[model samples]
Target: MEAIAYERATNIADAVKAAREPGTAFIGGGTNLLDLMKGGIAHPLKLVDITHLRDDGLDAVRALPDGGIRIGALMRNSDAANHTLVRERYPLLTQALLAGASAQLRNMATIGGNLMQRTRCPYFYDTAFAACNKRAPGSGCAARDGYQRLHAILGASEHCIAVNPSDMSVALAALDANVQVVGPDGARQIPIGEFHRLPGDRPDVDTTLRPGELITGVDLPPSRLADRAYYLKIRDRASYAFALVSVAAALQVQGDKVAAARIALGGVAHKPWRASIAENVLIGRTLDDETLREAAAAQMRDARPQHGNRFKVALAERGIVRAVNVAAGREPAGVTGAPA
Candidate 1:
């Protein structure tokens, strides 16, 4: 570990100001950032402690006047998963939060930290390899031709094929949540679909957040799909493993037909992939096996798989079909690992 400076911020303004300095980072739960620092993947000269900024409602979960929910960025993952509003109105998010990491991690991880978590690609974590574009821009992407079973199959550039590893983020994309952030310039809300960035030429940038911008909370709009939502994660083991493929599926059904659909995929892209193509194929259609298959096919139509991750294309397709089937009530929802 490298020598570092620490500052405890009493307010959001102070935190933002402190973070404006070069090589400064905000710490909420320090779940991911601490690990990266220990591994020498992240080397910040100074750390701004934002976990103590609770007077700004940064650690509370409250209801919006529009019947939506606002989740505080500093709220622990386990707390958010079991919150009354989250469990009753946004079960998809609850399921996603529970499906990630473990009970211990969920208790310590914050919502904002989860959103900022880096890709779990081995090339990025192991500094010895020296070919990860995300780790060192303009270098190269070793995963492009190296071990890639856990890599991306969508929206990948030649420079990088790493996938976002957060299951909660995939659910947020499906739920159409908005991230509330504040910085030196003031505050703004970034749509969940646009929060994370694709591994374009700039693979080093993980999100669209501006410099010194601090994520304060997330707003989830009201939706009728709460009762008909599901999160499915496929991994090498049942627990404590990163996903090979994960799907967050929610459907609004009218009578026997689909009125609307929200589907997001994880472990397949640099960002949480919103399956708009699949949603377009399912609207107004019956939830039949053939329809599910068609939706899955449409979703995977543009997938570009790497050498070692070609299996992910088919795996993602099946995962989508199964997830949508469960969400549409066409099939029973099976157990998805142990809850955090």
Candidate 2:
């Protein structure tokens, strides 16, 4: 990366002002920004270090008046995953974090940075490539008919098909985590499910974060059901690698009948893929093989896959079935290679 002007904002006000300038981006952990800059994917004229301004109780998880837990944006992934509240209440989130990159990466990577990482699509990251809708809107999506093992099967558009790459986010989605943003307009809260957007017609823009808006905190809701929740990720390696198909599930089973189920899948969609169809299918049913298979099938009723990654369809079904078994009070059977 060429030498770029750098500045540090010690407070949110200063950070907001610096971030509003054109070609100026905020740097929290610098894990994502630095990599993007070095690869020429991001050419911010000014790099404003907001890492210090983010020192507002990022390590603590507090209960809110509205029955939610506030998680500071600067909190490290490792801290959040191992936190007492996280371990007891959001087990899936903890499992997801543990299955991610590594303990060292978890220490350096902030919760906010993981939520904002750029697409892992190789074409978009390499500046040498000419056409990538996310890198340059309206240019084109090379992955449209190219290598898409990790692309979306849902909410895809003509512009892009890359999946959002965050294991924590998928678990958070399953737990109904909310986001807290500070901006020139004022402070606001956005539900985690709504924080990121579908590809729609413009996949270049991944979120609804307004200009000068900064994600300062995240609110995780308390869920009694999540005490038994779990996350299962299937990847290419046992080490630091992204998921090929992952499931984050929280189910409340009462005497072989599912009282409630919150299901979300990763590595298969633009946003965290919530199994809305499957959730409806399992809400009041027993976890027999037939029921599990039906729910799994329902989730991918409209799934469309490419040449190299068509196996994801079958893999995703098995993942859904296994995740359902866990939700049904059975120990995950012979789960190998990775979680699920």
Candidate 3:
């Protein structure tokens, strides 16, 4: 790891000031940052330790003018998951958090850090590898053709195909979460759907965050859509492994027909892949296996699989069916994937 200067910030302003320097980054939990540094993936010139900034630290989730939950960026994953408000109001969010890494990791990881965690592409992790566009700009993506079982199926371009690895993000996107960013220009809120981005032509840039801009909070809109929702994660292992294909679905069931639904897919996209088509299909339909199969297939209509990840397309469909069924209070029949 490169030698880097470290500074403890007493407040948000100091943290912002320290992060304004070139090649400097704000440290929240340091879990991802330190790991990337040791792996030679990120060698920052300066690290502004913001965990000590108590007041500015992400905390508090309050009702906002837009009938949304304003979540402080510094809130830990564990706390957010177990929070009475979150669990009661958004069970899908809680389920997504429990489906992620170990409890200890969740305790240490912050909401902002979770959203900012980078891709789990093997090429990106191996420093000796020369073809990781995200780790090194214009270096090319080796995963495009080499051992890519966990690569993306949607929103991928020629430049990159690494999937964003956050189960909670899928639920948040399905719930219509909003991101609040604080920078030198003050503050602004970005809807969670637009907060994460596809590689497009710039694989090097994974998110919409600008240099020196800090994530202040995440705002989740009030939803009748979320009252009935489910989150399901399927991985190679029963525990501690990254997702193979995950689903976060929220449904508004009126009698036998669906009034509304929100669906997002994980592990098969550059970011959380919301199944808008699937949601549209459910708005006026019934929650049955046939309807689920149709919506699930529609969700993957344009999914272009890569060298070793064709199974992900099938797994993604099954995942959506199971998750949606679970959300609709069904028995999750014929769900051929690992339980979350």
Scored by lDDT, the top model is: 1
| Candidate numbers, best TM-score first, in rank order | 1, 3, 2
lDDT of 2 by residue, 157-227 (tens): 77888888888888888888888888989889988888888887787788888888888888887677865
Please, what's the RMSD in Å of model 1?
Answer: 1.6
Which candidate has the highest TM-score of all? 1
Task: Give the per-residue lDDT digits (tens) of candidate 1, residues 175-289.
Answer: 9999999999999999998899998899999999999999999999998999899999999877788889999999999989999999999999999999999999999988898
RMSD value for candidate 2: 1.8
lDDT per residue (tens digit) for residues 175-293 in model 3: 88888887877778888888888997788787888788888888887878656777888888766788989889888888888988889999999899889998898789877889899
Clashing pairs in 3: 58-74
Candidate with more favorable, higher lDDT: 2 or 3: 3
**Residue 23 CA displacement from its true place in model 2, Å:** 1.7
* Reference-based TM-score of each model: 0.98, 0.94, 0.95
Instruction: Score residue 104 of candidate 1 by CA lDDT.
Output: 97
| Deviation in Å, model 3, residue 295 alpha carbon | 0.7
Q: What TM-score number comes out for model 3?
A: 0.95
Clashing pairs in 1: none
Off-target runs (Cα >4 Å) in candidate 2 are 1-3, 333-340
